[model samples]
Target chain A: MSSRRAPRVHGLMTRGYADDLRLFGSGKAKLGLLALVLAYLMLPFFLTSDFWLSVLDYAGIAAIGALGLNLLTGYTGQVSLGHAFFIGLGAYAAAQLGGPDALNLPLPLWLLGAAVFGALVGALIGPFALRLRGNYLAIVTLGLIFLGEHLFRNLKDVTGGNSGTNVDTTATLGGLDFKDLALLGENFSFNQGYFWLIWGLVGLVALLVKNLVRTRPGRALQAVRDRDVAAEVVGVQLGRYKVGAFAVSSGLAALAGALLGSYQQFVSPDEFSLFLSIQYIAIIIVGGVGTVFGSIVGALVLGGLPGLIDKYSASIPGVSTGSGDSGFISVFSLNQAIFGLLIVLFLVFEPRGLAAVWLRVKAYFKAWPFSY
Target chain B: MSEFLQLCFNGTALGARYALVALGFVIIYRATGVINFAQGGLLALGAYLAYALNDTAALPFALAVIGAVIASGLIGAATERVVLRRMVGQPVFAVVMVTIGMLFILEQTITSIWGFEALNLGDPWGVQIVRAGDVVLAQRDLWTVGIAGAVLAAFFAFFRFSKLGVAMRATAFDQEAALAQGISARRVFAVSWGISGALACLAGVTLAAGPAALSPGIGAVALIAFPAMIVGGLDSPVGAVLGGLIIGITQALTTGYQEDLFGWAGANFAAVMPYVVMVLILLVRPYGLFGTREVRRI
Candidate 1:
């Protein structure tokens, strides 16, 4: 029957508008997504190592932020070196709104509060993009980092000053405490609960971003990114899209920061420096620019690096584990060096990033019989 | 008034160093159309090299400085050949990130070799002072000003008269046009990087020449120079120098008047004063005081 071969993976058949916009158009993709959801739910149970779980948790948090950066830098053609500033803002917002001393709101409220706070600030800063472009815009944003750092350091009450403050916020959702979960009469550790919570949020954010980029506004953003003047000429309201992208991007960053603060239980000004911004940039670069899936892929690849480096530092040669050891480089320096090297190597060799590689593999499979 | 003059003297010394670094930034930006964030790394490397030659190897201070400058120049040129050439046609953001990547690598390399501990630079101008008309100037500061003036003047002269200078300007103006006229873009790029590295090294040497100034943290001055570069104009050498002096003097005045003038702003307001000034100036003059405004053709 023709039904057996009704639809093909790469068939050039007439497709409806709904088919074009479908996230998982192919049966294979839908099945793959189902498999992913199953694995996401089940991974924490099988992989119970505290170290690895924490790594995944952090990676999930970073993925949320990286997705936002991709939307800004990839989709909207804006390069912001002040991501760390916005992240710090979110962290502080969590500390203020969710901490026991402050409003002490629930998990959802704090997270949304932080995101909204970051978005408002990001909107305020977006108008500068209208006046400046390219290198000049980049430098102005760089100033934001310094100014933000100054504020973080001096504003002792809200940010807890340079010494940092505790982020002891409760993470509960409708009588289900993530910090201590009870599922089907089985008690789960904090790590297990966190893995589920963090990854679950990652999935939600990823879906949100994916849907956003598939719509008319998404096309507007891409146009602005490709050529702002042309996009404007073509009736794309440059200001609204640019500012909206920034707000959304920064909101995601703040959400990540809120999670990071809640999970770590502590955050200082030092945690949100220029290096943190660079790290996010590296994540997007190594993952794949302008791709939602690439952001998560990049975060997953780089998220566990520091943990892995620290774990194996004792065995690595020329790595001083402790201060004053007879080694050329300390473990910290080595980790940073590797990060820098990864950025350089990835940019030079695999500019399209790991996502592109995966896409190529998929393409090759799609053209299996007539591979040229 | 004397206190003000003293602060001015110190500011001038600091400004000279910023001028050198900013000049290097201008050279690299002009030639390659990419801001070389790795200048700080090169600055640290050159300063360390000077320290090694002067103290560890027991060479004359002047000779060691010269050797380090030459080495840094060659290293800069080699880096352009080996690493940056591959990134020639990449997006501006990508190229900028690449240099930032280089910055981290270079900084870590310096720390791995030298460790994080502060080291003495062993310059002859140690604690030596010259008093002149209500202002007490360090011998090193005086020498720094003198050297910077001479080197900057020499560079200006070269840029004004030399064929290579003309070639660099031509390439900076229109890369494809210069290529069509038979100018080797590669050579121009490499030489620009070399000159930038040389300028960075000189800045480093001057910075490290004073007592207890040769620390790993010395490289951070380049970050402040960013503001100086922007305030002066990205493409103008004279703008860079002026911006440096403006930032340097503002910082010095803030530091000097911290207790009286900036008490409410909190401690160490001077450290961030340059950025504040840069942002304020940029809001009014987008292209900076001396920067050429871009004329975009759609």
Candidate 2:
């Protein structure tokens, strides 16, 4: 009887490195993932409200961008205020490639093309990261936003100038048109279709990022974040990972921007302002700095806030909806103020953010039998 | 030749305002190692406050400017005390973001009080110009140069001789060593912010001196001043002024010659001119003309 090893606990025990690196090791985890998939497929059908669907769709797009930012900032430790630039780049790319007056490519082609374009531009900017560090890098990226805005306004033919351009692009994915989805003989509305498409892509990005972070390259990124010099001494190629991370992060941002342009059907240069970049930075900060799931979680929480505020501003006290109102400030000012307050409050009180809170809860439950 | 001189004169005036704002940035950075994004917010707030005091309260113009400067200094010190104190040991990224957050709040607070409409600053100088040969200067612009120069000279003297200023320099040199020497790092930080705020107000007053000059958009000049600060070197007061003048002249020249020389660059090219010059300079020097190279960065 002593020769036989005691029965290992299902989750608390791990046999090898393979088990340690498994995405969903326990049966419970696999079941939870299956349930989440079911919910994803079932969600749009029941929650058919246009407003809610739009909110969720936007959240999904923000999730994609935040995921990319997390990979760069949270994992690789590069702060960029130029996210809006890449996003703007993606939107214009979509407009040029997918618009009827232009190349009018299929959905996949245009979207992928936008991502590729963003990656290329991002790679070009990556060298700046090599040259600059910390505050210099941040200010340089801030310059990128202004320079990008200048370009967006001046490049009339491509960007349609400051007046902006429409993006009445198609959303068909080999017979599965996200514009009007029809699955198993049931037709879904435009918002519903888009909700599924965006969220599905979000899931894919989350999975892809998860996989990346779990691998050797992912460890390399975290090492770079922790101590770049130490990482260099330990045989990590600083240039390759740093540049590669930038390319991937910006590529993801462009992907989000393409969706935003297509969904809104209008791509304005002003839409990708420093404020937009700040919003993404705020989202990542609010959600969790470096965690993969935290980006999605943060997006879910903050992505719909502006829309919600805009929708409910009439009822909210101290927010003047129109001209000559009693309230001192407009809804726009209130939203920005709130964002500012949140960033300050979260950083001051909870620097690790909501992800850390969620982890604490999970950890508590996992070790329920013994507090230690 | 007159046109060139005119451009140089105008650029000098513009750069003077930039110098004041960039000096604020340099002081805070030297003391706290923080690039306060909220400096622009403070600039706007100071201008609005001046508007309120001069127009609403009907105070004397000089008194109004003084009051605005003093109030902004208090607010700046209070900000360091209340918010930034919590971020003492945090990384630079977190600290910078906190300032950005403060910026949005401050800007909104200004708008909420003053609204977005461009208002009269109630300045004594109203469309008054002084002609020097073929080059004409607005009284406000001339005063702007004078006030900026005076303030900068005062600051240089203060930093060189004043006990507090020497303490600030010591703290900037080594906070721990300064603390060991019994210098109050906290007092130095608070004083730096207060001094920065006061400078921002003076810049704001100059910027908002002309007729219908006071507006929320006046604050954005601080963002442009970023290039000036970078070009000067983040820590060097002298660099900030020189960088400001260089950028200011370059911008003025670009705008003056837009149609003839920079037609291909599109309209409003002068707005981003400073950034372009900064990039070029950084490519060669990395740390402005006079900034010390970082050794063993923490």
Candidate 3:
């Protein structure tokens, strides 16, 4: 009976397209997901440190932005160094719609408003993508960052100019303020409360993106990314899909920006630079291009790294935590150097990124003994 | 009229620097099909290297500039050999990001060594000006324009006559065919990067020699050079020079007239004028003024 059962369990062989598209293809995947969910629920309670909680929270925010970028550059094959522009747009939108001396809307409304605004702007820019290809498009998008910076700095009434504006957007939703959560008669710190809120959204966004990428539209996107001309020959409406991808990607970026602004409680023009856009690009690259899960993995690793470094700077040799310290390199320079090194090393050694490594490990175990 | 003339002179000088930088971009882009984002880092490195040679090593100004250029060229060649040579046949995005990665690393390394403080390059050209019919031009600006012109002429002649230059052009035109013709693609690539580095060094020294002190922000001039290269056409050397001049003049005029005529655009509108002009020009000519239109095959 045991020998017969061993033959019967041929291990999640796909018989059809639906099986291929299954989110959890095997019992192991389901178990892995369960473990993830359990960890998400229990980790905050176990750790209970504000510093680590905030780091995780920031990582979740980065994951959201990286997911958006992956959709654009990774999946759609559109290289944009202008993500920071849309992010800035969203931050200022939040400032106007939800901050003090403004309309003061609730959390959901402002976030949605920012997304809508970003989508509109993205739509306006999408026509250029239709005309230009490759390097031209990249450079034009780069111009958008400078143009956006100019607008942000000049629009003092809305953005509060160079000094930046305070974001008083409350995280309250249906009488449950994430800034000070009262859950099951237990009061949690702001960081603890925010971790749940941010990570929950991360899960939601991840699920949404995963579902999108698995469906017909997702196939169309990948098709366009691989070869736009061939995709067009196959009767894919090039303009609609291209514009739609832009709108969706920028909308997600804007949503992430809204979260970032509210979380930091300050929205500044300086915060949105070309470097920030590069950081998002790096995350998607390091995580795994064309894989939704890679975005979160990248964010968790790269996003949490800076904070960890800052916290342990005192212990690290040859790194000055403060100005006028006895060190050759400042913390800022060290961080920049690390980011650069990570990008170079990852592209050179493992172009497929962390997700590929994870898949390899899984494949090794799955093919145990057979070695095929 | 004199003020306008002065602005034009200043713009021309600025454009000369931009042309040098844009020309460097064209060389690398033409040969390897990779946009070297690290050019800015190279520019900074060159300027700083010159500073070290001149001030620290007590070399003559010309000797320091030559030494810096040679050192930067070697570094550029080594980068191509070590990192980018392996990236041959990779996707354009990946290659571009690699350069960007190099850029960040180079920038931070410079900052770590040099710190953030601005320092004079100690060039012979101080703040002295030469007046010509009510228009005052800095002596350094004149030298910049003169040197840029000479270099551009020499490069064009090299491309027209030299064997190695012809080989590089052949590689740029058709890599497989060039290889079939027995041209060493690796040597061409390394040589292209070296030339680009030397050009960047020249641009850096010229820009930092005048009133503008050498600082970390000197690298950012390469960002402005992007508009010049794009406006002229990415693959065209002559186009890059023309684009640089157009962008430089427009920027100068914008700075001179913004307060009086276009205050609504905000302060320092001149800073972004290159981008504005680039976008407008790109709208009309998607391939740029001199860029070859890409031919697609099914």
Name the best candidate (by lDDT). 2
Candidate 3 docking quality: incorrect, acceptable, medium or high: medium
Q: Whole-model lDDT for model 1 versus the true structure?
A: 0.90
Q: Could you give candidate 2's per-residue lDDT for residues B181-236 as a string of tens digits?
A: 99999999999999999999899889988864788888889989999999989899
Task: List TM-scores of chain B, every candidate.
Answer: 0.98, 0.98, 0.99
Q: Which is superior by lDDT, 2 or 3?
A: 2
Per-prediction fnat: 0.69, 0.70, 0.68
Candidate 1 backbone collisions, by pair: none
In candidate 1, what are the lDDT values of residues B141-234, reduced to their tens digit? 9999999999999999888899999999999999999999999999999999999999999999899887747887778888889889999999
| Model 1 ranges off by over 4 Å | A1-18
**What lDDT, from 0 to 1, does candidate 2 have?**
0.90
Best by DockQ: 3
Residue B198 CA error for candidate 2 (Å)?
0.9
lDDT of 1 by residue, A1-372 (tens): 454755454533436876677676576778889999999988866887889999899899999999999999988878788888988889999999899989999989999999999999999988887777878888888888888888889889788788999999999998889999898897888988999999999999999999999889989999998888899999999889999998999899999999999999999999888888988988998999999999999999997778888998889888988875788998878877887888899899998899999999998888787775
